[model samples]
Target: MSSVVVVVVGGGASGLTAALELKKSASAYYTSPITVLVMEASSRLGGRILPCDVPVEYESIGGGVLYERVQLGAEYVHGGEHLLDVFLSQKNIKRIPACVAAQGDGGPSGFQESQATVAYYCGKRKTFIRFQPDNTSSTEPWLANLNAHLRSLADDSNATSSAATTGKSVADGLPRDSFSREMADAGYGNTLAAGSCTLLDEGETRIMEVAWDKQASGDATPEGGMSRVIEELAADVCDAIRLNHYVHTIARDAETNRIRVGYVASYAHPDDANSAVPEEHANEILVDAVIYTGSLPSLAHVDVSPPLPKVVIEAARGSSHSPVAFASEAIKAAVIVRGCPYGEDSDTDLHAVICSNSLWPEISFRRAKVGDNLWVCGGFVSGTCAEDLKSACISRAGAARWRNETCVVLLEQLDSMFGDGGKGWRASAGQLIGDHDAEVVPPSNRVVGAAAYAWGSDPHARGGYTFPRLPGASHVRASLNAALWPDVRAPPFFLAGEACGDDDGAPMTVHAAMESGRRAARRAIASIAGRGTLQSRM
Candidate 1:
């Protein structure tokens, strides 16, 4: 029996999932044996789901050391009952509710509680405002009114058509209040000016996509981190993954009637400390099918012989489609500080605090226990804020400078928010330790370990994820989903990624990526079977 070979490019959540799905289900669809190969450009397997251990040492607190596992990339499982949830459940991974309330059964699977204590800091007021989950407090009638207005807007957007909402943005309809704009930014991961309302209504939506259904209660963080999910997906197909293999070209092999994948393999020099002087070797492989699971913008770097379909290329480039998908910038930073920053009266169980009118476009902080009197405070900034940060970093130097600057900013923000009059704690530049290293001596009431990641600057990802802009049409994603050779009954080239998600109402998430991968695998298997049938008939 003749064997079939399938090449999965970009070993991210989607790519690895595609390879694994092909390996498991190919036999049922195709009569011949199927061989799956995963080409990962980066040195690591989890493309954007990077989890690292930052070493922390505090001599002031008995002089012990610990490694804090921090997720530098994708962290939360936005919704439940998806492929990711199933994987987590199957792996027996712990699921920590992202939100919890001080009262009332924690409000709809603890989401209500999360919403109740959402502390918003007003830079203008120089104070924090908490919106009670239940709007019974007449003291803040405007808060309840604003919440109602926002809900009404969401409903109206849902009722309206894409054409009617075209050229409109979330900011366009938002109340002319800084807090309102910040709330929108926190949800959409983009500035109100750039976040398209039409896309949210008709195109892909984020956590707000689906209502509070049984399947999707609310967001949750996996116990071990998102890396666990990646590990689970790649467990069986570990041998198939080729890290540091950059696929530069996918062309048709006229002689064999198969797809030829050309890549460059990087080998680190034995004596190089920085591995900057690595050797590059060009390689090629012939495969029956190819699944390109990279981001849309990344397509620009890949050379496809004879070119992909015009519509597909257009969609990838965001040239033809109005309100096309754009790469979004999101930065995440975390620091291990001494003592609980929230104070004794503050809600210790608080999940996250969304800050408005702050240094960044939209910043949110979450606290997790690291050890006795040691807490890890993590902050997230995205949308316009992240873009500005990226630009600033580029203007100054590079990502390293960005990380250093972000660490300092995060420390300052934390101090301003938690530190009384910005004096509760101070940042120790001398004692701050990198992800790998640990400082022997600890400073009093200072940050010991700090780490930050700018997903937009990451070469492998290009950006945090894809989001639609104003005047966008839902058909753009459909165009992105088009096969390389749609006219062919058994096209050899296909595309799958979070960006390719269609009108499923699912946002660009890990589950969506996995689903796309599975879909691509099914198409590849069917195409392989169809090709075999055509050959036999000929």
Candidate 2:
């Protein structure tokens, strides 16, 4: 068989970007055109770009993924500037700043929400320090910043539990008497667990072990929603795209090192009725290279020949596959009969109200552009976002929400926050470019404990981006980026994904994923094109 240059598996941003780059760059190296195949478990191409189909008036009522004024997922992006520049530049899209300092009461929002915390060894009950701020003119709206400072301090392995121990550290700056006293009482130690942070023991708690340190300086992102980020990338090869194609597995022959891939045909059994061969089975493809870009839950379905390496199987199984969630027991619609509240002047900082349980959402300005003119403008809500925001993002606050409109209610999980203190906020549908506005009403249901955004629950991305609990990180990049001489003989199976690399120990973000894809493509070119790891480029 004449080898295939690359087989890209994922259909997400990274996979698509890699395939696009490989298709364009690989031609220069190979005598024969390098063929690239993108295998996705789902039928559609936008892996996590599912947008809300709600109403523009919901902005006044509170519902949206990324308001035209604030960026959500990719909102607070930092390190991947170069990466951002390339994609945005290629797509002719412009990026805007979305970060600002504490805009509320100067005293720490002075409020905090307490979360369920379990002491690892002691098994003692201490709360994870969370905030339940009064988004009104109570205190320093810098609640997010203050908490961040505390987190940075908490992340410091050497950060003395007591200022006396480390002699004037971040702990010293904390207003022990002001508000975080509650957290201080709960105590701080390496033998602790917070959120999704899983440590391999105290040794892993070392300062450098886990740093929120992004590659480059991170800044507030698009107020225009990050969904547009993935959209623009797709525009490049949208023509070469296929939707609703579910891949069942990959078949391989160990003896000859030959491989065949399969997919679930849309219309099958009927055509092969009463026949030994059903055309509806997996659609197989034989090529020089293969790449899988689906999520972990999706990976469970791929059929690799002779079985995947034991190590690979074990690691994949062990890795945590969860989604970015937003839960609310009651979906409240706060419509001010008088004025719209948003931007600089308002107390909520104009961002969505994502409560501790995903209330009072503080998304970036960059995401706002994506909004279809649904942001609540002017004035402010007097009371805390409690009535409408609630303790969580689980259900609609009223019967009207569920009965009057459409919504998928998720409950019993932690709200996942990205770079900042936002409770994992998702999308809410709105009006189009020029559409009629609708009345706003809050949901009748209210969440008690947790309103999680479980991406694992989402059919699209088996789970959210990769986390670090699973093993094989160091070996991740190598396997995905490896290439062999097919003419020389051997079963070639290379892998690349944020799940596959170290990325200097950061969790799976868009940055790490894209980098892994490039590494894989470059490796294919060098070995097959007969070039070694060339300087810088590779």
Candidate 3:
């Protein structure tokens, strides 16, 4: 039996999962010896699962410093009984609830009582609306009505049809109030203008597939962070991964029927003086099969010898198609404070603060403790807000400037929401110690460390994740699931990523990525074995 060489184009969760699964499948089912290689464009193994260390110094308390690893990407484990949860359990990684109510009696269902405390601040009214888990019925009738309306859109057939025909976006079907619009922005990670009604309808279908089993299990995070999952997934396959190998082209040899992969050995930093000069020398490798797990937007840049099917290309470019795919921009920023910034009256177990009708209409702050006294307040910006931030940051130069600007905005927003006449945060304004890389001095003395990541600015990942932009665009996901060479008896090219997930699988989740990888791996193995098809098996 001849040895089979399989090359995985990206080293993200999907790619790593594919490489590991391929090796395992080959041993279990095929006679040919399989060699799996993962090519990661960046210098690290994890693609978007970046865990960054922020060094914090307690200058007010005699200057004691410590470095804490904070999740810069893909922090939460969405549901349970998925591959990610299984992997984490096997690794003995503890799972903690992402949200918990600070003070609430158990609800009729028992689940609502444990729900996180979400404080809604209305900037226009200069008032705060607290959504207490136990008091949803009596205190906030509007919130309950909103929830019922959303559920009807998903559960009632007539409501779905009405939404599909009359509205361009999910928000269009909702009440035109500022509160409703703000809630939509926060939930969809995009402004109401960008939310597609088709996407919402399709998403509801996908949710139904797993909602029964997963409804009881809420969102969770590992004891430390998502980095633990990456570490465990890459443990056995680390040596097979090639870091700093940027794949440029993928071509198929008509005569030999083998796939040729071309890549550059090193990636030049965008800020480097010589970044403008293209690498004169390129490296190439021949493999029996190829699995691409990179972002859909990134596929447009890779030169395919025989162009991908027109629909795939259209999906990649977000151009003319029944349904177009758009890579949405998102930014995550976090700052470490010496003490709880919510003040003394605030609950210690407070989970998140959601602000509406403000400068950043849907900006929300999530709280987590990294140390005994140090707490992390993180905010995420997406959709049009993210695009605006990207444009503003570009005018200021590069990532360093962007990080500083983001931190400043975070502190300002926090102060505006929680500060007393904005004096609380302003009084704490001292020289922002630690993180010498940050050029801008923060305006708060409580801020000990700061960090931010703009996914739109990342060269490898042009945006955070992908979403259907147009009315019929949700169908593109099904098209993406098919292999590039589906007609071929033994297809050599397969696509695996969160973007490639089908209706049965939820897109844009870690478990979905892993499931796609597993499916692609099984198909690749069957193809190599001359089995021709694995659709039924998968």
Candidate 4:
């Protein structure tokens, strides 16, 4: 008989959800009793999706804005409606009414453009790695399966229509599919293509259910911030969490076949990023297992006994270490020197100012409540790789910017050159994007974060949640997911998180990650008991 039960690591959205689902389903589906241990790395619970209060005076500054410019963080929620539905069923979250500007709303709440594709720098790759998925496992102890799946994707050249109608890669959307087309076109492509590239193989997983429409609508927030949702999820799994515990190492016991987790709980405190620390531990934590939800850089810095495999390490790097920076200078707010002449809507909440890149239009009075004594706080998303998008936004810009005519020109060209799967290739990307972000919310901070949450760069994700970048990205996520399979004899080891998915193509969204956690718990419960007890009697 095995000692103890299943062990879950990380307490972020994925970890917490996985633990709860397993515990819940064991009683319902498996008819078995199960206990799960969650191991989180940070002193705080919510990972990057933090939703704190920003004074109205401080609106138009940092990652927070009043009329809600949702600077560069998990502010707007793109295609997470399904997840929102799930949250509404499970928590106290409520959606607010949003008004994305149409051309002639008597309200004057008109938008210039919108998009569904995410734009980020691929570093100097000159060729930014276009992430995509292969819909296969990386661990069957063979490379043939990988090769086969990739070939199928590459051969999807029948000019067929895919489930996604968004735009395509800039390279795939050129005038003659020419080099200049790739150059003249902006660095970013359609939202679906970006998801395909970001999630790589993981996108192949059910997470692909996400919709990516720039001109579309329906993105939202927790009426507050994304953290409220995280807090709600945490409430369910609070019994298993231990805060301020900094994990140090993980080990495996050859004799007992059990995993050992180690960490220094309370060590010297660092006052700042460059603060020095003492060696003594004020507190400590050790476990039989560990779930590492930290970033790739954080993972690389930690120590592990018996160590992980080369493939896992390689995948971690490929999936997380994209040299892309998050610049959002375009969506910046300006000091209200002189307010707009036609901007006198008492009930109006959010508004946009369109301008040429070279002219570099300046905006003022980006506060929640418009007033004469307005002072706007602002910052630039400097050093980021996607400089083009950063230069074109005001407050909340991005794929959702497709509502603008100026943005339509860019999207239309992209679609004409690379229609859904490059079929008709004569329409506009903006039109396709129109169908993705289909909900109705003013293109505020909530909308932008909703749009960016799926990608990794939204500060909350630190870089579009996890996806296969190099060849190994899929393997890491897949391997981790499989480790908890029912066929295995040892106690199941479940993994979830944008970073903890299969190399076989998975999209990183709270919804996808949540479903993954549920599947993991289900698989673990099935594996622990005999297969006879897997399916319910009913």
Give the C-alpha lDDT of model 1: 0.62
TM-score leader: 3
TM-score of model 3 vs. true structure: 0.84
Number of the candidate with higher TM-score, 1 or 4: 1
Per-residue error (Å), model 4, residue 257? 2.2
What is candidate 1's lDDT per residue for 1-538, written digit by digit as tens? 6667899998888899899888877654445577788988778888768887877775646887778887887776765667777878888988876662111011223555243244556554556655565652475554554454444543444432144443455444556664554454444444322332334432222223222222335567787788888888888799788888778788988898898888887722232111232233358888899999987766766788878776666645656463455545778877776656666444444445655555443343445446556667666666565776666655544544656666666666666766544443433534353312222234444676778887766666666566444324355566666677765667899898877653443456687788878889888877887776322222
Q: Residues 360-415, candidate 4, lDDT per residue (tens digit)?
A: 11111133333233322221112132243344432334444522322322323222
lDDT of 3 by residue, 361-414 (tens): 333343445445566777665656577666665565465555566666666676
Which of candidates 2 and 4 reaches a greater TM-score? 2
Give the Å error, residue 198, model 2. Answer: 9.8
Cα lDDT computed for each candidate against the true fold: 0.62, 0.38, 0.63, 0.38
| TM value for model 2 | 0.58
- lDDT agreement of model 2 with the native: 0.38
Q: Report how far residue 203 has shifted in candidate 4, in Å.
A: 14
Select the stronger candidate by lDDT from 1 and 2: 1
C-alpha TM-scores of all predictions: 0.83, 0.58, 0.84, 0.54
Candidate 3 wrong stretches, greater than 4 Å:
59-62, 100-115, 157-163, 168-178, 189-216, 269-281, 320-322, 345-352, 359-370, 391-400, 420-423, 426-444, 469-474, 531-538
Clash count of each predicted structure? 2, 108, 2, 73
Best prediction by lDDT: 3
